[model samples]
Target: MSDSMVPRKPPSKGFAKKKKNIILLSMLAPGAIWLILLRYLPMFGIVIAFQKFTIYTKNPTLLNNIIHSDWVGFKNFGFLFTTSDSWKMIRNTVGYNALWIVLGTVIAVSFAIMLSLLTKKFVAKAYQTLMFFPYFLSWVVASYFLMAFLDPTYGLINHLQKQWGIEATQWYFVSKPWPILLTVAYLWKNIGYSTVLYLAAITGIDTSQYEAASIDGANKKQQIRYITIPHLKTMIIILFIMSVGRIVNSDFGLFYQVPQNNGPLFPATQVLDTYVYRAFMATNNPGMSTAASLLQNVVGFFCVITANSIVRRIDEESSLF
Candidate 1:
């Protein structure tokens, strides 16, 4: 046999590397397009916030010629902050979001922990499906459902009160009960996703660790406290850190639509998102909405930075960075 006739490996065909590149590019293309169209492209509109936008103006440049449309740097932001509604919106946003984070984490973690303990796969799957169903519903749909139960006249709550010989209550227009209602609605709608996330994290834990804990005569609660929670610490910290970013942004539909936009509920229901919507409605200023959104992003960025720093200080492993 001639040495020249011997077969060689043919340089791996470089298929693996080429395939990886193709896969990465494919994955990135959709997201890149989405960000450009929906997220990044709209950033050009930020200039509107600086300009005195008017409907009569065909374009900002043309309006600048007819009117003294000069840059009012920080003036809109100043108006936002100086208004009486500013403090109220900020307070409502922070309060509701804080409550949501704490309660949501607790309920989701507890549900996930309980689910992990269930031996029956079918039962667990059924529970998960039922929980997830609500998450799929749009806020508009959920608002209608909420109103059916809470409406002042024909609502179930009012009907029940009447049946019990009590005066039927007007709840939709009231500010007092909204904090609790909003929190409950948020939990009901959001718990499924968080539960699924925590469950996935739990499943990733090594079974050998649990067996060893069992051998050590650890009770279920002890196993959970020592093993499960410690394993989840990093995920918990990461999710909480993410939640901090949205502390200023409320669930707009929940605050706006659920209360049916009745003015009486403004004190309790108004948050930065809803307040911005109302402002935009009155003045037809997209700039104010943009400004509000930009402010939210700025605050969220600082909050995330601060939160991650604190997390890193306490536990470097748990820090998102």
Candidate 2:
């Protein structure tokens, strides 16, 4: 046969697979574009962290500010460590985060396990809804709700205390009591969300494993200790790794709005986040804020890496990486 009359071979299996993968990948394009626009693009402003960023009086665009600003290098970073309140801020931030991470995990996991034990589907759903409701409420709105119960005079707690002939506490102004108050607020607002996540993971577990354990004369506690918990090990490790990554960050609204920003409460609630906000507001310095934010992100990034490495070293199968 002549070259012009040669027949072409059919598409190979790999070629068909590649075509199918391309179509599937196209489905992710929208999410990829959104991330690039909102997350990745803004990372270009990280340069402002090194600059003493000030708007040019003649041409004050953000780009112009970045170009005209003086390079202060590590000086902006030094501000975080050099301030008199630096130790206090760092302590509060790390301490609160540590407490939340440990307590939140224990409480969320325990609650999730309890919720999974609910035999009635309707009751389980109702409990989930109640737990999840606070996650939807904005911090601004939640602050008002907290104020209603904690108000010194007419607040529900104070009113009850008065009725019982107890002293009324000015909750917002008392720094000593805020540790407990903030802990409660943090858990109340956060635990439900975490519980719902673990509950979902628990729901995926094979019920037959539990049935088998039960037939072997294992009690409910024993079943949970072995079958239920072992199945949840991977999920728990992943969540812990994610939580570890954010160890340097705090919920700004919880520290600020929950106590209504009373000066007296600053001793207990002046975390890095709130401190940075206060510093930026006091000096109107973008460079300072940018440096603080960059520091947090870098620390968080390393934290995640370190946590994953530790988990991988112990149990390769459970590591997030």
Candidate 3:
């Protein structure tokens, strides 16, 4: 029997599947490497949260500085609670987050529904583009734009006030309106993103359900109540849980840059992130900043777990495990 007379066996399905899986894994390699390096590897430095974390020229290396730092137990954590501004910052952070969660969900869902109802596709796209542009603008740039509008002497707002026979108010110097301003700013920049999410979910729904409802004499509101809301209930719960997890993590740029770090606005605008930044800047302490960040993430993690557990109890299919 010559070799040429032997028949070649076909590749097995398991082998083909393994090859396909290898290709898919190869495609994911870059992102996996990036995640490991930038995210998980940094977890090793978390010990800095409990140390004095001093730097020196003896070794002049990151690992050396971390290894040489002295442990101070819970001293760094005390900085968050012992200050006079602690209560205020915590209150502002939680209050703004809670309010934004409510407003963001309501406004985003409403806007998404309205956009979905638009008969014209281009008009809906135009509106989405207009709303989404603000989300991309950095807080630094946003602050400059805000300054242009709120500057007492030359701002467009003051200019309009003069035209309307009203007193030109110095906006940054005032604290009373800051909570409202910050809320509006957050929604203006963020609502579009959430709206798009909900809109995508809405588009995935079967048009026949709506059509059937319409034929059954159900009105637009009734259809939304019966079909749409029930379909979106999962997404709403997921987003709500995610938002709750981030309740302790304030946006540093929004609190710090947007208000130009004004002194008077601290009463209304100060948050844990801004407080950590100020403390680190004043004391040049890495431990305090690291501790605060660690605390925020720990709290956020627990919040996510607790929310997911509650959801699992109510609806296992919709729960985010």
Candidate 4:
């Protein structure tokens, strides 16, 4: 065929564009559907917070119940705040979470920095694997493991006490030691995950900074303080801001199961989550539970906003938003 008369292939711009769009949509489909179903869809149920919800009615469908239920403005919330245990629940919840956020950050960051500085890769990986083992453990399993140490008659603690000629203590019945115990448990379960995060951040740091610091005669401590810590500050602040959002929400299993639901330890252990669970189980009033949940969400939302605002003011780069 003559050179000018040869057939040329059609352009593929449109087909390529369409194929790219399809691939993007396919990749996003699962996550988009998940968010719609699990996150956005449940937001509609927040209306039930204001309604006195009943599970069994002549018409038991969700829409029917929502429409038929009586609206009680803020009364459900008032119920949560009016009881004598209200202050106790708030105190325990906020107190324990505040402690966890602070201690968890410090311990996790310290561990990550130390681990990253390890001379041997195999030793560091082994230690990391051992530490991370607890993060996968269910809180129920962790509670039983804790019981093995705190069990009144035959626990390791009591066994040691007996060996030392000290009287065996009823650990579950006592509230004094629980704050420490719960903090320990929280650290043990969570430190591994947080360490992994911080360690990942640490690994991303530019090694040139350390090399320059070394050239400047900065010691390990000096280099860490000036370089490594500054590099991690952003991640630390971001995580702290997120943690603040959950300040009102207690770990239900940690507060409920860890103490074995001992009534005597309620003063130390009962937080907003456990309180709401107990109240719902006792009264079957979804309204009150929903109100509590709604309040927590609202508070958490504001907390994130406030934390981000504060971070923005101090260090704009570190703000979550």
Best by lDDT: 3
Runs of candidate 3 with Cα error greater than 4 angstroms are 1-6
lDDT of 3 by residue, 112-228 (tens): 999999999999999999988899999999888888989988899999999999999989999999998899889988999999999999999999999999999999999889998
Q: List the residue pairs that clash in candidate 1.
A: none
The alpha-carbon lDDT assigned to residue 89 of candidate 3 equals 89
**Best model per TM-score:** 3
lDDT of all the models against the reference?
A: 0.87, 0.91, 0.93, 0.93
Q: Please, what's the RMSD in Å of model 4?
A: 2.0
In candidate 1, what are the lDDT values of residues 1-321, reduced to their tens digit?
A: 898989886656588789889999999999899989999876777776776666445555644532555567777676588787888888989998998899999999999999999999999999999988899988899998987898778789998999999987789666898888888888889999999999999999999999999999999999999999999999999999999999988888888777888899899988989888888899886667877888899999999999999999988989999
TM-score (C-alpha) between model 1 and the true structure = 0.90
Clashing pairs in 3: none
Pairs that clash in candidate 4 = none
How does each model score on TM-score? 0.90, 0.94, 0.96, 0.95
The better-scoring model by lDDT among 2 and 3 is: 3
Pitting candidate 1 against candidate 4, the one with the higher TM-score is 4
Candidate 1: deviation at residue 286, Å? 2.0
